[model samples]
Target: MAGKQALNIVKIKKMKQDANPITVITAYDYPSAKLAEEAGIDMILVGDSLGNVVLGYDSTVPVTLDDMVYHSRAVARGAEHTFIVTDLPFMTYHGSLDETFRNVRRLMQEGHAHAVKMEGGAEIAPTVHSIVQAGVPVLGHIGLTPQSVNQIGGYRIQGKDEKDARRLIEDAKALERAGVFAIVLELVTEEVSAAISAEISIPTIGIGAGRGCDGQVLVFHDVLKYTSDYREKRFVKTYANIGEQIRNGISEYVNEVKTRAFPAEVHVFAAEEGVIDQLYGKGKAESES
Candidate 1:
């Protein structure tokens, strides 16, 4: 496949204007990022959802800026040609502006990310504006922010009611005005998501927010079935059951080993005729002498 064209805010905005649906995937490691790039993904997000899918955490709350930097570095190395965005993680951007700038700098300079994605609405708009002013691109996320799961009362659909829908629209507008290149609408009702997309000039990337979005993103593990125990999300449409395939392959290998079927003649290396015997005999002779 051809190499991915490097993306920037101009190109991303053009994609939205042209009605070309952008493709995004969350990749936590080198291999997944490389594969996603090869598969022609438009963007790679090093989401804090790695806390759940890769690190075995129940939620994204515990993910730290260091964790994000480590994973984002891996993804950046793997997909140099693709646009990469790294999450700021829980509380990383909620504190002082200095702290937020430090986190964004780490993600960009150390982690090698092209931009940073922050989860919140108008409340975080000023922070986003400040970061953007400092020459750091920001991707805003609203609707069911995972970092606020406890406060939001679990992973439920957001903006289902009229009041919430209006709020979501305003959030999108606020984010756009704050200089966010794009926004991610997660778990909002389809109608509300569509309204937000229409209300904002920047692209809206949806995860569980239906097809009304200008772009769609899903976790790498979710799309490829990386773990058998991963409770399938309604929004995720698994493209491959690699977990099952891996399990079956491993089982076959185990069975072959137990039955002495593996390491067959073709798999084994043979020395010259009588070479082993000569070595042993020579060693014995030397010892005896």
Candidate 2:
């Protein structure tokens, strides 16, 4: 769990047995994922959330399979211990049911994601079923799915009404039947989320679905305070203001350079006596040292 072997079934099984609710964060690159790994986060999702968080896009619709693959590979390099899951971007899966198999294989084989996640339930069950049948682990996503944000009319809470709530439950069951290792319930009612968690045999990891879920996941940027300008959501519990720290550090560095006060002794390199003599007279050593 502490080494190069990425998150494995043993860890996931123990995670399920512990009942402590695993915490997952979206990490788009090596540095961010390395930070998440060092911070002891339970999982790393190379999410298409990167469209907004990393690529500065308005929505996940613009995120492509190649974009996800490139970032997932970078994240996989750093989050060697944390479970790394990548999203199947728009059109790749929803375009055609048969195409889902081809795209999912490319994700696992090329992107290096342990599993793939897709939004929707009963409507996407056959696709999910086929992927699992082909031996790829699938994680189901329900509730306020981002890929269908246009159809859903912006990010909003789901499963509040009886019809929507029942549909959410049936969607969970459908995904469970299709053999997903876990399900992500985002922006759904907490009570409904609890019911689904209770009913489902596999793990239910939630975001904006409240504490009743078997686990919770958040985008790394949101959790780390990287997107300070973005609206804070009810589900995001920021653990640190790393963005501020990063900004301050950069600012201090700029100030140091501006004042010519940087290159502190410990930060500067040393040269051999003859090398220094060859490069300059004796005064260079005195001033540099």
Candidate 3:
């Protein structure tokens, strides 16, 4: 197979202009990143969703910057050409501007991320601009920002009413003006998300925000049945039931071991009869001495 072409801000912008739908998937480790790249995915987001998916956390708020950096580096090693965008975890960017810059820099320099994504709208535009000014690409995330789940009162669809829809559109515009290369709209009303995508010059990557987006993103675990514990979401279309297959395979292995069917001749290393006899003879001589 031909190697994937390197993706950058220029290429992504061109894709939006050409009306091509971009593909993005979350990957937290080397194997996941390699698989995503092999599948011709356009972008790999090292999302703080890892907190819930990988680390057994209930929400993204508990994820630290260090956790993001560690996973981002692992993903970077596996993805050669696919664009890597890592999330600036909660509180990392919500603090002072200097703190935001520091955290973003760590993601870029230490984590080897190509871009950084942060949640918010007009309120965080200034920080987005500052990060862009420092020569780091920013991907703005609006609508149902997970970091503010407490403030938003849970993972509900945003911009439902006319007033809030207008606000979402304004936020997308503001983020574009602030110099974000792209924006991610999560759990937003379809009409409002389409309007925001239309108003913004940059690409709009939707999670649960419907089909009117310039692109779409889904968690890797959601796409493949990596875990059976998660509650099904409206947006997730599971392509494979890998979790079931894994469980079945493990059960087979357990049965084989219990029956002593495993490590049957083919699984064992054999020794030459002559070599075995020579070793036994040597032991006999040593005992006699």
The lDDT values for all models are 0.92, 0.85, 0.92
Clashing pairs in model 3, backbone N/Cα/C closer than 3 A? none
> Where is the poorest 10-residue window by lDDT in model 2?
1-10
The alpha-carbon deviation from the true structure for residue 61 of candidate 1, after best TM-score superposition, in angstroms, is 0.9
What is candidate 2's TM-score against the reference?
0.88
Greater-lDDT candidate between 1 and 2: 1
lDDT of 1 by residue, 1-289 (tens): 2745789988998899999999999999999999999998999999999999899899999998899999999998899899999999999988999988988999999999999999999999999999999999899999999999999889899998999998899889999999999999999999999888887789999999998999999999889898968686889899999999999999999999999999799998878876855878646645676
Model 2 spans > 4 angstroms off: 1-18, 228-230, 264-289
User: Tens-digit lDDT track for model 2 on 231-270?
Assistant: 7777788878888888899999999989988978888987
Looking at candidate 3, what is the lDDT of residue 192? 91
* Whole-structure CA lDDT of model 1: 0.92
Give the clash count for model 1: 0
In model 3, which range of ten residues has the least summed lDDT? 276-285
In model 2, state the lDDT of residue 248. Answer: 90
Tens digit per residue, CA lDDT, model 3, 1-289:
1566869999999899999999999999999999889889999999999999999998999999999999999999999778999999998987888888889889999999999998999999998999999999999999998899999899889989999998899899999999999999999989998888888788999999999999999999999988968579998898998888888999999999999999699989877656744877646745776
